[model samples]
Target: MEAQVFQALLVFVYTDTWPEVEQEDEPAMSQHLLVAADRYGLERLKLMCEDKLISHIDSNSVATLVSLAHTSSVPK
Candidate 1:
């Protein structure tokens, strides 16, 4: 369940389909980072996204996250 949620959030973050409006339930891309951070225990990834990563992470970040979740050295 967590992984699924994480994937969904990742897609939301790394896609142009993201909505412009900021709402409580509808978080900004940064919020997805926070979710990933919490679920995967990726503090650095979260901070990087919060600080300098998200802006640079292209649309492919979602696919990267999916791939990472499937097979990567990173512990999740």
Candidate 2:
């Protein structure tokens, strides 16, 4: 996990909220957070990340998002 990703996870763990991340960083942050949340059994966080990511779907990001979905099995 990246430092920012871990830091956001820690923030969420403690405060039930994520730190302020820039708009451009939200997708990647949510992706990493989704994976971390699953690995740690943080179901609500995982679902929130999934929802955030879904809203970010776009032509430029779709392929990567599909790959993440396949690899992480997040929707299932």
Candidate 3:
């Protein structure tokens, strides 16, 4: 996990909430968090990160997002 993502995960663990992230960073942060969430078996956090990713889907991001979705242990 990245330092930023790891910090966010720790915050979520302690407070049951994700720390604020910049709008432009949201998608990338969510992707990292999704993987970390799965690795740590944090199902609810995984879903939350998935939801964040879903909202950001667009032509510019679709290819990378699809690749990540296919390669990672993100739910199908």
Candidate 4:
């Protein structure tokens, strides 16, 4: 993915809305999510939620990503 797309995805995943996701205007939040999901290996889940709203990023796949994101501090 392009750097801009990656950055946009990060913003989308962390923010609550498209407008709140970033100060600069860009493509739709869904596009960012799709790119991010592909770059981050969450394509399957991202596609599942493609037609949904950006606020639905907390679904199963995202939950898994959230868990994985915190796994570094988890005891093995």
Candidate 5:
């Protein structure tokens, strides 16, 4: 499987949420999880990813994250 898919499965198998996983500043990993969650219509999973993303928010990257959120159709 592709890396993104593998990462999503890892999120499910390893932790209750993506933030709980120890990826450590891996925004790409989190992004993958968010996309997978959205694609699968897993609202809980998507929210978990969104919450995690919010937790990591910093001024410098906030715009990028917001852009990602918009592009991904993440909820407010």
Candidate 6:
């Protein structure tokens, strides 16, 4: 689990998927990083994950997202 998270973080940190080519991000990717962020005291990374999760939230996923946020000890 930690290995996968580390790999994803590697991609996120090193790759420059941008205006010309957007990143093919997985929904759970940011969530995984959120855990690592908390564990390692990566504040900027945590904020980035929070922002990503916020943008992905919607009516259909609100309940699940809220639950995940609570589980992660994130502020609502």
What is the C-alpha local distance difference test score of each model? 0.50, 0.86, 0.87, 0.48, 0.69, 0.67
Each model's TM-score, in the order given? 0.30, 0.88, 0.89, 0.31, 0.66, 0.64
Better of 3 and 5 by TM-score: 3
Largest lDDT belongs to which candidate?
A: 3
Ranking by TM-score: 3, 2, 5, 6, 4, 1
Which regions in candidate 6 have their CA more than 4 angstroms from the true location?
10-24
In model 1, which runs have C-alpha deviations exceeding 4 angstroms? 1-27, 52-76
Q: Please give, for residues 1-76, the per-residue lDDT of candidate 2 as tens digits.
A: 8888889999999989766789989998998898899889898898889889889989998898888778775764
Task: Return the clash pairs for model 6, or none.
Answer: none
> What stretches of model 3 exceed 4 Å from their correct place?
none
Q: In model 4, which residue pairs have backbone atoms overlapping below 3 Å?
A: none
Candidate 1 colliding pairs: none
User: RMSD, each candidate, Å?
Assistant: 11.8, 1.3, 1.2, 10.9, 3.2, 4.1
Clashing pairs in 5: none
Worst 10 residues of 5 by lDDT: 16-25
| TM-score, predicted candidate 2 vs. hidden true structure | 0.88
Q: Which candidate is the best by TM-score?
A: 3
Q: After superposition, which runs of candidate 5 have C-alpha atoms over 4 Å from their true positions?
A: 1-5, 10-20
Q: Model 4, 1-76: lDDT tens per residue?
A: 6666666565556763332444233224544555456556654535533544334544555764455335422222
User: Weakest 10 consecutive residues, lDDT, candidate 6?
Assistant: 16-25
Q: Per-residue alpha-carbon lDDT of model 1 for 12-49, expressed as tens digits?
A: 45662332434433324444555566567656555544
lDDT of 5: 0.69
How many steric clashes between backbone atoms does each model show?
0, 0, 0, 0, 0, 0
Tens-place lDDT digits, model 6, residues 1-76: 6676787666656662211212445457777788777766767777877877778777876887777777775666
Error of 6 at 35 (Å): 1.8
Model 4 regions more than 4 Å off: 19-32, 38-49, 52-76
* Ranking of predictions according to lDDT: 3, 2, 5, 6, 1, 4
Q: Whose TM-score is higher: candidate 2's or candidate 4's?
A: 2
